[model samples]
Target: MANNFGRVVEVMVSNMLFSMDKYAIEGTIPFDNDLLPNESEIKLWNLSKDTISRIKRNETLMINAGYRGDVGVILHGFVSSVLTKREGVDAVTSIHVLDSQDLSKRKVKDITYAEGTLASYILKQMVGQLGLPIAQFELNQDYRYEEGYTASGEVTDIIGKVAKDCGTSAYINKGKVYIRNLRRGADDVFALSKGTGLIGSSEPFEEEKFKGYRIKSQLQYRITTASVVDLKCKDFEGRVHVRSGTHTFSRTGDFMTDVEAILP
Candidate 1:
């Protein structure tokens, strides 16, 4: 009683869709970006001379992976590097890409904040200064800087501090920024049933000394870091907030999303 049940993966460079012939795209997008930036590796086989020349550094990269009725952009970034290798008779190419937020790795000369400011206000000002799009903002706690807080390091580092002060997670994905409240409850987007795309039983795990769950499911792009999921496995039945996840696509267009989440 469904429309479709197969996998479809598409990659676009600089807003132009590219052929998937002998190509594969894969990457992980973290929910909590306090550590690394969103990145991906694209492998192209037997590229034509013209196509090879089209592949350039600094071009924008966009990837959408889905199964059946669910489809959305799962990865987006700038092409960081391109490498060509000859394998016997065919030339293979690998493209490395980095999230848009990677541009914020530079030190922000100076940033001043007023006393008794709302965490959301501080985050808004920070992202505005960096020119990053706002995907979502939920942080509302107030932050008081007795002597005023001044940012003098990497922009990402300063944003990370603001996130910690509000007890939230902040990061950029697909060229959009997200500032989520860790203490707030989220509505379950979808109920993952055991017989419906659920790859395996949800198991309890430990991550960073915090309780978490490891989830494996067929490829779908609607869920991302900060999205709340309701698992209906026989072993576990509750909501878990996604902390990080990996979306992988094969040469045949098959896709999978593996997520690590913590209880809300």
Candidate 2:
């Protein structure tokens, strides 16, 4: 098991920032940012009455967590709901958030593209309509519609279509949109070994005919969805593509990232 001491967590609600490690008596954040709109929850206990009162729906929420000197933002989304309940002598608040707001459910009116329009251009226009900032926008193949094309339906569906046509994939991370080649992973590649935070032996897995492993490591922000991780261990020694995962932190000594990945 990794040392994983000195846990740190920061929560920003709109302009208010709370150092969870100090202010919160207990909390846990579970996030899975993958294809489709990402949704997660933040639960904190024993927050000050002032802070809890100030939190409201639709406010921007950003969470960062890791060990000391290794922290990074793990989730960025808008508050969907906030509920507080009295448990024993503590007040526990559960805040639900959704990434990209309502963009995934928003319907895109029918838009026609003339022949010779690049697939990337269409994706850009659609994403622009959603008003979210773009982090990375690159496609493996920018297909040109020689016969023109029409786009309609949920914004996410159209994005999926464009990705399929261009042999790419689309997802939202930290409130930013990304459309990239299916075979390619994120820019940072993390190496995992016993010395590098690998928690235990990875278990082999096969899903949809794609073989990979289910891995757990000390909680950190570097291994997110679409991240590339090189595994060096007794059972596995190779690079795997992160498909989906959750970063969890709690006061009960449960700080880890559980990942589902595939060989790529």
Candidate 3:
């Protein structure tokens, strides 16, 4: 079912985080509506680390919504969240979009969506704009070290030393995204750290912009499902633009089952 796959897709995407090498960061950033649905105009803004391109809502979005009909979103939740971050400093509002309400419950189209959250921002940065080429990045491991004193020659400086971790530089690759780049497209990193299917918010109640964004969450745990059927879509097409999956993803038929599976 769509809802089931929604959860499954979340699971699979989260699963990808551990792999962390699917995409590499580059300096050449490209934006395409075909790869990622729900596209409107883009709002380019400034970031301390890099230049950010935000997708605006009020745009036409057509995915493999289903045989029943199409869902025209102003913008995808990821885009909405970026806008929310820009507009409202620390607040997020969203919805639980039950996929294809008209379809049968036994069918696969049923799905639910909520507003964005901290994790959403992480994923947005990881996925970046769908069509946009990979971006450059700087990676860092969030590890810390401790120092001990025994009245003898002090222990070596091991504080904040991460063994196998590396950061990517955006200026070098011309916006190319490497699996190692944290700020580039590191959505899976946080999810792996957290563990669960992710939910997102479109409108944040409180808005503020600091160096980039710093968040300490006020908690609420609520519940939530597809492959990405053929996702025929429009203008957006290419290798990265092209849909990648097995199990014969299609543009029609049981919409739920089609997009239920996660890519790779």
Candidate 4:
């Protein structure tokens, strides 16, 4: 009376999602960086001598990019946001360039198919952990499919939680993305970095660490249906001749509910 066909699909799809997300975070964090495979591209912000002395006495600071004059500079962190606000200028901006030799290129699905498939896999996993029956069937089969939508949308929404705790930009597009030791929802878009799928609002969170940043799970699950029924039958005492086979109980209505007893 046990059917594991559903479980087989569940495990396969869930494993796919989990591994893909894990790789997304791992791969992106170092892709834009020049470090080796085993290296980590993360660090806490170190303020300038002037900035530090000022913050010690004052509660805020202002920063401007053009103030560096003729040369470009890279500044990262929350302190930068506070400075941007104080400077009274736009804190973010972006411009997409065409590296494509063919401008006719376009997209109906994700520009990154693997990650999109990956997003679907992650979504399948999150809903599975929701402990809701019909969740998989509902989300996978019942939902409408809109190109450039849904699967990637859901994965981005949930991954946002982990990214928020990780204090990094958790985004996906094309084949590359980046992660850094960012402030809770800070983005590097203003630095000409394009970002999508940021971590969003959710329930209360806790402080824990994985790798280094504080971490918390946005997923939970439980069995939605489970039961056992007792079945009984009288023992048959007579043995029939092997050459003469006899009809047993009629096939119709002969089935019994499987019994599973848990003893103390």
Q: Which number leads on TM-score?
A: 2
Residue-by-residue lDDT tens digits, candidate 2, 124-195 = 988887777878878888999999989988877887788779887788877888887534844688998888
* Models ranked on TM-score: 2, 1, 3, 4
Q: Write the per-residue lDDT of candidate 4 for residues 1-264, one digit (tens) a residue.
A: 221111100101111221111221110011111111111111112223443233321122111111111211111111111121112332211111111111122112232324224333443454343222221111112222233233233333453443343333332211122222222222221100012111122122223431111111111011001111111112211211110010111112111111111111
Best by lDDT: 2
lDDT per model vs. reference: 0.69, 0.79, 0.19, 0.19
What pairs collide in candidate 4?
Answer: 160-199
List pairs with backbone clashes in candidate 1. Answer: none
Compose the digit string of candidate 3's lDDT tens values, residues 1-264: 122131110101111211102211111111221112221222222232222222223222121111122222111222222332334542222211211111111121212223322222232233332223443223444222223211111111110111122222121011122223222242322110011211121111222421111111111011001111111112211111111111111122121211111221
| Model 3 TM-score, all chains together | 0.16
- Please tell me which model should have the higher lDDT, number 2 or number 4: 2
Ten-residue stretch with the least lDDT total in model 1: 21-30
In candidate 2, stretches whose alpha carbon ends up further than 4 angstroms from where it belongs are: 25-35
How does residue 189 of candidate 4 score in lDDT? 19
Per-residue lDDT over 94-193 for candidate 1, one digit per residue giving the tens place of the 0 to 100 score: 8788777465556677677766556666667777767878877776565666666777776767777988887777777677877776435454476666
Candidate 4 stretches greater than 4 Å from native: 1-71, 75-116, 120-207, 210-264
- Clash counts for all predictions: 0, 0, 65, 1
